[model samples]
Target: MTTVVSTGSYDYLTSALTTMPTPVTTSSTWPQVPRWLTLRQSLRMARDPVGNLNKVLAAYGDTVHLYLGGVKPSIVTRDPALVQHILQKNHRRYHKSDLTHGLLRYLGKGLLTNEGADWLRQRRLIQPGFHRQRLAGLTRLMRAAADEWVAELAALGAAQGPVEVEAHAAMTRVAFRIVARSVFGDSLSDEELMQLSDWLTAIQLFYVTTIRQPYLRPVQHLRGRYRQHDDLARRLRELVRAAIARHRTAQAAAPADAAPPDDLLQMLLDARYEDTGEPMTEHQLIDELNILLVAGHETSANALAWAFFLLARHPEVQDRLAEEINRELPNGQEVEFAGLPRLSYALQVVQEAMRLYPPAWIIDRVATEDDEFQGVAIPKGSVFSLYVYGVHHHAGLWPDAEAFRPERFAADAQPALPTYGYLPFGGGPRLCVGSHFALTELQLVLIQTLRRYRVLPTAETPPGMNPLVTLRPAGELRLRFEQR
Candidate 1:
């Protein structure tokens, strides 16, 4: 049997790794759940990891050591302070594990995978792409994308009363459109957009499957599954390359005085390094485009899907949101980036929805050198799963953690949030560069959709958690759209 040394409030953990239920000792300071126990609970954990981990943490304390997949030794923590230390304050001591770098095999070395001074350089170079004025310029593209989806809903529900739609599929299309349009402008066609979405989905699905079931590597290699996915990734790169080529050709063909399109691709092409006074090489630019497309698309889609799901379930919330949105963007005015602050309730709802179901559910980091935080010892090469989902849901961090209360994020809300309690966007120096663009895009989508249709809950039960590369609903999420 695996013995739990302690279990108590995370606050006291500053004094020790954690307080135990049984007698504590120097050797047992960091208690490990027996491999056998981890293996025994493997099937259950696979089905409901969030719930299963919650049970283990409740018994073992905020942090515990265990074998991931009954094989690899690692520590999982729901402690906000620990998460903050790894991602921010003491981040230099930690780097992403192969678990994240593995994406480089398929996606290439972009900002998400780059490390050290190079990653810092790239961050500084790319930071300005999302500056306030830049995002304000992109709002038109976002609103256009959102309006198209809303128009589609109106068309669908116009003929049929309360048209039934799959929220995940719908949101996925809209999110992809928004990102694709923002990145490439009119460079890609609808068919190409669809193809890109399919390819990215396939690549991500295969990558996560391999990561989760490491034992399948040999079999996958022999079966040529890896080869097949690599081919898909190659084709994806080619499509992006073609877009770049087209942009270059057009830029060359345009009049010398004419301005190029105001989009992410243009921003990347124009950006020059501070020290070198040179733009990124074509290969580096392509890698970033790939990363941005994937990062910007899937995460936003999942978040949007969850937001609509919550709104459908909580009609009262939708009503309040409608009232607020109406009061702010009255007369059907579109969501301009500058006016986002006025839609405070919409922002709160988005914040709360992410708190309940964060897209980046878990983040993996490894200690680059031996380090210690509080009283816990972290040796070099130690693997840590900063369970962002767990941190968001930890009762000690959020009162009534399981409840859907958007007011918790209100301007004058009581009991302010803990340092790292919320991580809808992974925090620290790497806090998503597109955070402003994403928040603006999400609020726009919500407001536009609400203006056109009332997202009503269906008879279907709640969707199960499908924690893959990102947190997604296990299966299709169906909802009804009653045109308002």
Candidate 2:
């Protein structure tokens, strides 16, 4: 259990608490609960890490100082307005927390987990990659990838009995391939691509193991797992360096006005920061590209797996989605981005799934200076973990919070959720740049998939959570695919 102490002036702390806009009054029941939490009871059940937040909030009320280990965990407001104020208005006073810094030893400071000027610069440069116009062109490529996977699943459903979905493996492969194709174009050979994919999967597993075994931090330096991550990083760096060299050589020999290839690598090569009048340095390119490969795939893969799981559990929802997909494509044709919104129900299914099992589940930040949040005084260096799962699942915020109902997102539906209540993509100035890209990919995959087969959970699969950097299915979330 972490214990957190307010080392600052006692009066300052009290004053800050007293100023809360809608402060918890002295007579409120929230303050009576014990600040320090024991590991044996509530903590054990919260093995998924953030799962026990809602329970804690329910018992202790909106603001509770949980002492675990030796750190003070101040679980504050789930209010959206408060969330926006913290993440957006007061963002300058906060940076990525220590937990994110620890994870970056493996992930690097891709836009997903970086802070300061470097993060700002990377976000600015990479934003164009996800621009609506840029993404629309990639739709054909995304559709082709989705179509191939759907065809494979359809074949399996017809030929095999109760085929295992291999949710993680399947989604990971598809997502990784799409990012690779978008970034590197044809620079990587088929064998090289497959090898990189396998290495990435291994590295992802190793990273998860390290994060799960919190004690691994001290001994990680001695473990083969740490070596494994280092080796994978080296290998990935080598591959990117080779690709960059190849691209440079090819570009130098090509005509000055030649049309650039339709790929992310070419786009980066051609791009220049307007203010700096400079292209991304080789090192910057490599780091950001690696970020895309890791960040892009990990979250999307988890979301896809969860969406499938949700659809499997709710067959009526699945059937409705399938009907919409069929109705749109009477001849069972491929879907385009322009027609993607036509699968509104499928989109809702994916959205609802993201709410229940957000891949980027926990958002963290470190206070740069003493800050006041809705009347609460947060000492400088104090870490704030926005429990997104807790917020999404809080009964006060979501009506029938745990139920799988997509219609809640239907037009004119009035659940009256808080501002940050449905932040699957985060919010404010630091909102996810690739949100549109992820949604586009998810919609196409789900629609094409439903058009091909029906999904049912496999008997061996259990509904468990894996909380690493992203939330994922803990075990083999296998499912049977029956051809429609």
Candidate 3:
């Protein structure tokens, strides 16, 4: 028999649990619970996300039965205590759920999907690549790229032409390029870089579309998009193989006394595995590169697109940010590493935007062992999804929740807010390692872009949101840009 146990954080779970009259029935021999209409709600989540999920939270409470193919589903919990319990105290008892596992055909054994010692080892090997000291040097490169993008936008805005900002496409291409240069240095050609990027985008979109199809709910292997996906995957594998070969040749040709290239690829080549006294295998290296390409690029691009959409809607906020950028860049030159720290308000605006539209919007996990919280039991294998959007939008958790108010994050005010309440990079040990790099990238782009042009939202062309993998503006982002 299944039993419900309550970890006392009554007030925190109130928003999610208040609606339930009696604790839910859960047991080994209990009759199967009827499928609730709420199960269908997960489908509509990508459409009207925050609003719909809020409804579920308000209706079902903290822990409730959501019959997904006859099994219970656990949704959101505002209880920071329970969140702590799940993410830290007993993380071993939980692993990334199938939704993330299903993402593996595209993402490979990227840190986002893996667990246990392998995840630990991979994370350790890759962590130094994102260190602040190492990343500080990349800021100049990032700023230069941001300036080029700004100049293009400025010219379009000056023409006053209808600009369709294929935000996804544009950002995807640029982000892939950034990671390529930053991670691999000059080992990869622009031509090879673009080819790899095109295939990555195609595969990502294909995987996004195919995974959610309803009919494939039963026959996972017979999914229609697999063949096409395989074609793209095969192309990407070939491209990566070529790049690895080129990198080896470059290393071999270098002078015996020459220093290593100061790029992430070189860094990876130099990295050692304590157990084996050897570097990562070419296949493992490709998988890690695959991880960086997708996890690094898509997430940042989506976050930037969402940030721009928010800025477009709030012209006043954009202007405030523009003023900050202008003050920092009064010389009318492209922003440099020295100028980034001065753009504090611009940074806050981006931070608040992430709070409103986080790219990795939802995170899911499955219980490996039975667990309980506040008189509710989470059976082994039960799927749990943290509705980050729902938690961010919860009225009680965030005052004036829907409003885009960057002031809430003013320097002095930031430390006062609850830590987990605004988790754009997530919480616990699994918090994003690239967060420092992503934030630096966004800050550079925001400062450089806003300094050069005002991105005015088109009344006729509303931002299209497609919650495929990340929450992105669909149809590219079409904006009326006006040069500053």
Candidate 4:
């Protein structure tokens, strides 16, 4: 039987005890009585998860039981072994949790939110599109986009004194353009890209509020929040429809002898189900595209912004990185797809930055069947949060966890980590399909940006975490760009 622990009793019990509570003993039955958060604590957590999570870590150690009002108790864990068990070892017994289910309103049944057999099928079909060779072919397109952004920054730097820019916003525009060019090819117009970006930002904000604070749902509904979200989603769908129509028209206009352009949109349009040999319907295609647009750009943008922020605060590391980039690609030369491997320091810098500030800060999963780990009973339907941020910062896992040391990720110096300890892209069969894509983009952008300008810290250099749909800067990450 599940015992409901009241917050008042927990506080009394803790206060009454003179010594630290004994560690829970291993047992077939549920091991220890869980400590529940008070209603006030739950509300504060919803508003500031990263801050509260840090507090919980300090108070409860690696694992904690959270009780959100009106919702079932959930477990949050930072233990690498438990994380590995949930994400890799026993992955089949678990599925994407309600946290992702809440995204269905915005993303629909796409790869990011879809579950079970359909998700598996879609993953298999789309996997080929992100293969290394396919991504390699798009290197020139990626470089071209990076070059355009760098040139724009150059113009800004020349026109202004140490041009101040919001790194997150700037990176979002660049990343979105790269995804648009890579995925939809030339089918999307500039206006359409801007509209899609705006809509996505609105939808993300709406999602964060509704999902995090269920208690506020009534208030949000009264404010027509859902209507605003629906309107943005409708406009986005129309944009996708228009792009698809353009692709179809281009295909029709081409001569029979001419081959259609090899792009992500064409790739998806040409893909067929293995068992049924059927293609995705227009709606399905749109959903998949929406997922790509949302997933493809946002995470990369946050990561790039954070990487820049870290580099700005650590100028010595930035100087070393710039030196390496200059040695590899002298005089701001165009980056070749084949030459990416040579930029090892730049790659290390990106990896270390991601370690400190993983964009996908938390991963949630729900068990399909009752299970136990280390004598703790995990009931079926129990929500498990794999706290990526916590694990990355866990003192036991990495020495000097709070310090930003890119050298720690250097090939020769990198330390061994537990299976699930470093999950920037997550793990197991469901590992982010865009991992290689994102890494490549970060490398190119870093190479281009540093080669052109020195990213210096301003008053807002080291930004705080926002912890929304993704971990973004709590506020504007303002930085100065001085032309090198």
Worst-scoring 10-residue span by lDDT in model 3? 1-10
Best by lDDT: 1
Q: List clashing residue pairs in candidate 4.
A: none
Candidate models: Cα lDDT each? 0.85, 0.72, 0.69, 0.80
| Model 4 lDDT tens row, 256-340 | 9996675789889889999999999999888899998888898999999999998998899999998988898886577887888
Q: Higher-lDDT candidate among 1 and 4? A: 1
Single out the weakest 10-residue window by summed lDDT for candidate 1.
1-10
Off by over 4 Å in 1: 1-28, 158-160
In order of appearance, the predictions have TM-scores of 0.94, 0.87, 0.86, 0.91
Q: Is candidate 1 or candidate 2 better by TM-score?
A: 1
RMSD of 4: 6.9
In order, what is each prediction's RMSD in angstroms? 4.8, 6.9, 5.3, 6.9
Clashing pairs in 1: 5-20, 5-21, 6-19, 6-20, 6-21
Per residue, candidate 2 scores C-alpha lDDT tens digits across 365-478 of: 778898886566778876666767776776655767899998876654664334566787777668877788889898888887778778887667467887777888887788
The positional error of residue 428 in candidate 3, measured at the CA in angstroms, is 1.6
Write candidate 1's Cα lDDT for 1-484 as tens digits.
0011012244533433334354222543566777899999988877788888888877777778888777878889888878888988899999999988999988998999999999999999988988988888889999999989888877775436798889898899999999999999878888998999999989988998898889899999999999999999899999999999988888888899997787899999999999989999989998999999988998999999999999999999999999998899889776777788888999989989988999989998999999998777789999999898988887666778888999988866766666777877888888888888888898899998897688888898999888887889989999888877
Judge candidate 3 against the unseen true structure and give its global Cα lDDT, from 0 to 1.
Answer: 0.69
- Model 2, position 267: C-alpha lDDT score: 80
Error of 2 at 71 (Å): 4.7
Best by TM-score: 1
Better of 1 and 3 by TM-score: 1
